[model samples]
Target chain A: MKAATPTGANIALFLAGLLFGLGLAVSGMINPAKVIGFLDLAGAWDPTLILVMGGGLALTLPAFHFILKRPAPLYGQKFHLPTLTQIDGKLIAGASLFGVGWGIAGFCPGPALAALVTLNSSVLLFVAAMLAGMALHRLLLE
Target chain B: MENFTPITGLIGGLLIGCAAVLTLWASGRIAGISGILSGLLFPHKTDTGWRALFIGGILIGAACFAWFNGGVTIEIQTSPGLTVIAGLLVGFGTRLGSGCTSGHGICGIGRLSRRSFTATATFMFVAIVTVYLTRHVLGGNL
Candidate 1:
């Protein structure tokens, strides 16, 4: 009868981001050229990154199916999966913004944050600005 | 989509996916990056296990990426200032939108949440179009 717990969920999310960043780094998806290549419709279009993502998806589907049916999870009390289903303007806007940022920087948040390990000023600046962005949003209560 | 035998790809995906499922099972919460982040920011909630684990996991995972890849071959092509700014934008978007791609796209869509479907679809579209504009129209001049 306690309130909701998010320990497992948080770890899952962090790991997901970490692994995602790692996949980008290991598979070379973090490389701007590779990402741009994916976006490039007229060029050589190296689809190797796509393969990485596809592989990940393949592995993900089956496991989730089996896991969701269990009565009680290991970390919390109930499943907190969302139930809404529809496409809308919010989706379009957010995706557009995310894409623009990704295309321009060649660094998604997880990767960008991870990329900070390189110790380059540019990376640091980006991380700082990212933090600033978060702060600004928080201040505004958005 | 076929002839893919990279154990790294499958195993990595399975591990991350399993982690997400388990966290959901244990915490009774979706492994949404945005929500976790918001919780950290807003501070009304009491649970913090998942958040700590998630952040820690990201750091460890990033190191693992470098380790597995013999030192993640990273190059900084952009200015740090610009990158930070980009991060801010993403943070802002994440806040305004109420969730990040992980929450909406992965967990939300998986659970068939209408809000998540819309959010995920929107995020994707926004990402795609934004990339197009920034790279194509704006020329990513930043």
Candidate 2:
């Protein structure tokens, strides 16, 4: 009657994103100025973001353990796990670039889009840059 | 929306994480965000049903939140054209990196995948450094 956990997975992912977005909105993390302020430790640093992240982690950890104990999942057919190791230039380079982009914009793609709903100028810019970044990566890869 | 009392992040994370696990268990998929998005980007002939539905679900979810919560507070601090460009760039970057934060950090790392772990770590490092450079070095706190 049902396909796979796409229903659940998709729903979950969407909901998760919603929550993530909501967090940004509520915590004011979506604001580049606030984010920059947090980063600006030497100046007026606002560490509220740490609390938001911590709260998310707290909720996720227990759920993660509970789900893992199950032999299988209801929506998904198999446990989607990964198996790989080793760090290289791609890893370092990607991270650095991502950080730089994030720093400049104070908005990652996820949060940036969420912030877009707010109709802020900085968020808009960051989102534009992010999409461009994604396109460029695709060309180079494929 | 601003009036809504935010749920404890722990609760939100729980709901989201369980949904992710269930999807993996049911679909035999890794909950790789990039993969799902990439699918949308490069659609295959036979993948219309679930894939389309999935994409629909994402949009629906966002809309639902905005509607039910009285629409989110959109803060467009930047230009519309630029934001779109950023999104494109992110799309490219995810493709290049083979995964997004969700895939690498949550799904991949959860399963002890070396690649995911490395990727997640790299991404985090980059994000941190970017914050420093933008807020401290360049002072582009728009």
Candidate 3:
């Protein structure tokens, strides 16, 4: 099979992103209040997020197994999978911090971006701060 | 359970899985929103167009959803101050840990990566505890 051209690859990526965002919107993950409700296990817990995750995992597990069997992607030269295997202080600390933030605002990266169409002031603020935080990490750590 | 939405949640998750699969098939890239967003922020030469288009697609997808559905409901429960702080933590932490819900929680675990499992468990546990502390202990909605 001929390798896909750059344009074709970019088109596929765009479509992928579109579908991902649509999923978030449809699943109500774009709503911070719903996300917090899921997190609040002690409160009137909402298990919708669990089912969402379960559904995602159910499909991806088998799909990834089959896809990785191929030597290369249909469009790209190779799969750019993560190679890190260590469980260290940085990973734990970073995840812990992220969890705190998520619990506080109920806005993870994907949902926040998808929700940007809302043009809500809070969403805008959160996203701007998030970008600043990423820049800060690059400056301080990397 | 008042806010539970099992059907939409499952359907939306399957769509997200399909998005990840498409990205892997076409670009050999993880559909990690944080990583994708960061790449746009600190762009590398010869690797910027697709990222931009992908993000654009997310916004467009969301807009399309609202247009079709008459408007998606998004509630931001956190105040502006807390939203900014949470955004900072999420941005920094996802970068430090190297993935968010879509990346680490879904794709990474689906690939059976041990590191992803550890990160997911750590973040999930911490997020739960944080919610418990904030909602139950603090006795006020954050």
For all candidates in order, the CA lDDT equals 0.57, 0.53, 0.89
Q: Point out the higher-scoring one by TM-score: 1 or 2.
A: 1
Q: Weakest 10 consecutive residues, lDDT, candidate 1 chain A?
A: A41-50
Each model's DockQ score: 0.39, 0.29, 0.71
User: In model 2 chain A, where is the ten-residue run with the lowest total lDDT?
Assistant: A52-61
Q: Give the DockQ of candidate 1.
A: 0.39
The reply for model 3, stretches above 4 Å from the true place, is A1-5
Q: Candidate 3, residue B71: CA error in Å?
A: 0.9
Top model number, DockQ = 3
Q: Residue-wise lDDT of candidate 3 within A3-27, one digit each (tens)?
A: 4338878999999989988889889
User: After best superposition, candidate 3 residue B109: deviation in angstroms?
Assistant: 0.5
Q: Least lDDT summed over 10 consecutive residues: which range in candidate 2 chain B?
A: B1-10
Cα lDDT, model 3, residue A31: 92
Instruction: Give residue A119's error in model 3 in angstroms.
Output: 0.5
Better of 2 and 3 by lDDT: 3
A86-107, model 1: which lDDT tens digit per residue? 5556555655565555555665
